[model samples]
Target: MMADDIISSFPDEILCHILSFLPTKHVVATSVLSKRWKFLWRSLPFFDFHYDGDLFDYDRNNEAYSHFLHSVDSFLLSRDRDEPLHRFRLRSDSTYGHPVSIQRWITPAVSGSVRHLDLCLDWGFVMPSVVFSCKTLVVLKLTFIRVENTFSVDLPLLKILHLNNISSPEGLDLSQLLSGCPNLEDLEVKGFISTTKGKFITLPKLVRASILEDLLPLEVVKDVEVLFLDSKYQQILDFDFQNLVRLELILQLSKDWLGVLEVLEHCPKLQTLLICIYKSSFDTFLAGHEEVVWSYPQSVPACISSHLKTCSLKYYSGSIDEIQFASYIMGNAKYLRIMKICIDSESHFTFGEKLHMERELSSCMKSSDTCTLSFEYSS
Candidate 1:
């Protein structure tokens, strides 16, 4: 059979499915192949727009940026409006996006029943409120954008939502947004959370949450099974994590070491625990001049004695306080099966010092006979 005959043998649906796997740029380039394929890309249910050049120097590359914007507008507007949009992903570092143009692109996607929408733009303008009310949206991710407080959010079917560096000077009340998304399952928020008088709301379906906000209430994530918390938070661990099975903490050495133990005290069913301690400039200075005291807890937490199974410590400096903390866990965790310590070779400790620290950790009492200790070094 001839090549064109073979190509035209498949139905348009099959051809469109085959074309959807390629990048939209490559897919659009297929338009010149033949009349049958000229508008084949227009029927695709997915739209992905990614600017490929040096987006940092916008002034020097204005023409290219403008061309990219124009291409995005053409691709989005020329698509089959009757087809349901499954996903729309646009990533650009250029901040030249006008609010009207943004609305023009998103309004159709929302109207066409878009399910997943991801926009990672450096544009400083507030997003169109039409996105917040998407009823068919299952996933939404926005970065480097400011969300206004007046937008009424009603994403009833949204399951996974990620908001990175989204701000509102008037203090965006998360409770107001979350109250609308009743079926949300996975959530991640990283940015400044201004004060709001709204009461804490509970999400029964929420399973995993990673929070890097400054002032989020504990009630918002009280029911999550897996949780990640950063050091930037205030009063983050003030409530109990009754359902948390796995926990990850990113902490700085400058904070109170006792707070670590305080967090362990609340997770009664925790099985996997990972802690990464980072050294800041101020921490390095303090480590050089002063000794950080690690006051051992009077009693082992419930999880350590019964449920805790695996633990990881990253950037293990083998300092007096760190060793004390490690020794405490090694000596007490009755169910601990594995403990890994990641050490930095560029740290102040010498080869012999690291060996000594390992020996010290090895000599500690292990409540579980199957427990093993391992060390990894990174330059």
Candidate 2:
């Protein structure tokens, strides 16, 4: 007869499904609504526990932290073991300062066959080894966690993996982890701090990947179709990506025109190319790079002549080397459909400088009759 009674009269399975979309804390708080909801949350397939610094009062934060920890333990302990955990997420600010307790909280989810696990922990926390061997995990994301080399990882069904701000006790052997994932499709590794040399081990089914790293040697995976790289490393002469269809390169100040050309010569199938030049100083970094000393290749790469369709250049300053590289692409890319040049808004360029750059790029002889050139200022 009442609205609340009408909604509660629905099937228990439907109510559980509705509660799955809510946070675990809210789901658990519903226990006081009615007798039917008292134990309904225990059978939920999804569990997400997040604790922020402001969630507890500074004066009595310890009591709030203890309650949060106890709530997580009780939730996991009360879960029916036979029911599969569809997803489990835990993000904490280290209020308790106990790493062993975090491991204990994660064990039951793994045993219950959690399909998705997202963990964001404070520093000094090493993930339990049981997570490495989670075969039922379809998606796993870890942030600010240390990965040890001794632990064996065998995520057979993992499809998407994101590791941000990850560290290693010993140098992390990425090859071991990549070899175990047979179905990995999308991978993103960002801000990875390692004492040993970092490597990007390739997998056959990996279609998209992004890596933002320091001056580390990159072993580019040839099988990745779409790749984004933001690196400080200058040694890119050995990069060989034959199957790359789309590429976005965020360059450092150390990268010169020759370095860009060297990478373009290797990607034979690259269709969409986006280059964002990151300038940190007013000094001409590309100067004194012997721009004219190096002989240009006699013929253009196959990708430029046939495969490359769209090319976008961000932070384009009217430098001699940049003009040369842009001219080369416009002159050689026979199949190019659109070429967009985005000028750096931060750089103070005169009206004459902007007009000259636009005229220079517009006059360049394009091999493709259908090619269109446009210019814009970066937003």
Candidate 3:
């Protein structure tokens, strides 16, 4: 097919898919490609206005940033506000030069039309003073950004919310967010690029959640499918995951594995459990805590998922604590079948010692039927 003819034959949907992978700068530059491509980028269902200083860092005093911001504003302004946006992402590291700078795009993209909203501003500017009551939003991701007092973005139709590195999310209350999002499903608060030092936040209606760093707690949320905890704090978690199915615990062993176990008591059907217990770099935790044994519940609640058949552990060195924990699950998981222990290379276990682990696990199963315990290593 001729180049121009082939471009003309391509469907708008296909064109949008091709454009989504490129940088927004290139997407906009398509306007200069030809008349056929002028409005194609605008028809895209998703907009990721991500600014990478590493790629196009303009001098703070230069006209490039302002010009770029204006171009974004123009595109949003031209779009029909009523048109529902599927995904909208905006992020930067510089303090947004002006408060109004964010509103120029946020105000239009919001308004009960967006289904997936990702609003990230990094360290750039303070957020706009606007309450986005998105009635049709399904997934909402809010990253590092500051907001003035009295701010709320209601997502009545929201299901998944991934909050990463919230800066002074003090004014944002979990109760209001929960009550507003009556249909929320998954909530993940990852402190990847940002950290929190104040009161932890707790939300409502979420079924799966990850609490990392110093994030706040959820006063209430139920029917959870998964739970992940990664933090440096030593506080014992005291929440009840009544119907949780999968649990992932990642933290330094020095912190305390039992604190993580305490959180699992409420789970009635926890099927898959992955414990990445950093073995005190593979020493101090096992030897240091061997005498301090835990007094656990007599019966590990299997109601949440009596169907649990597989288990995996990382950083496993056949430590007494590690084996004891795994044995507790084997005893309670009446239908347990396979348990895989992956010992991290950073561990102190010898090749023969690891082989010994496999032999010991052979007899660890509770039932007459045999369960496989495969011990592996990480590079």
Best of the candidates, TM-score:
1
lDDT of model 2, residue 81: 65
TM-score winner, 2 or 3: 2
lDDT of each: 0.82, 0.79, 0.65
**Root-mean-square deviation of each candidate, in angstroms?**
3.5, 5.1, 5.5
lDDT per residue as tens, model 2, 1-379: 9988987999988998889888899999999999988888888888898887554466566667778888888887787767778898989885455688887778877876889999998777887767879889999999988876645778999999888988877756565667668889988888776553335555788888887774234554557889888745556456678679998988776546566666778788999999897766544664556543345678777788889999898998766656777778888998899999999777688999899999988988888888899998986
* Candidate 2 Cα errors over 4 Å, as ranges: 1-42, 51-82, 93-98, 149-151, 193-202, 213-220, 230-240, 282-296, 315-320, 342-379
* Cα lDDT tens digits for candidate 1, 291-375: 7767787888899889989999888887778877778887889889998899976787878988898898999888888899999
| Superior candidate under lDDT, 1 versus 2 | 1
* Model 3 regions lying over 4 Å from their true place: 1-10, 21-23, 26-38, 55-85, 93-100, 151-153, 190-205, 213-219, 230-242, 251-262, 278-297, 303-305, 344-370, 375-379
Candidate 3's C-alpha lDDT? 0.65
Measured by lDDT, the strongest candidate is 1
Model 1: worst 10 consecutive residues (lDDT sum) = 192-201
* Candidate 2 similarity to native, TM-score: 0.74
Model 1 scores a C-alpha lDDT of 0.82
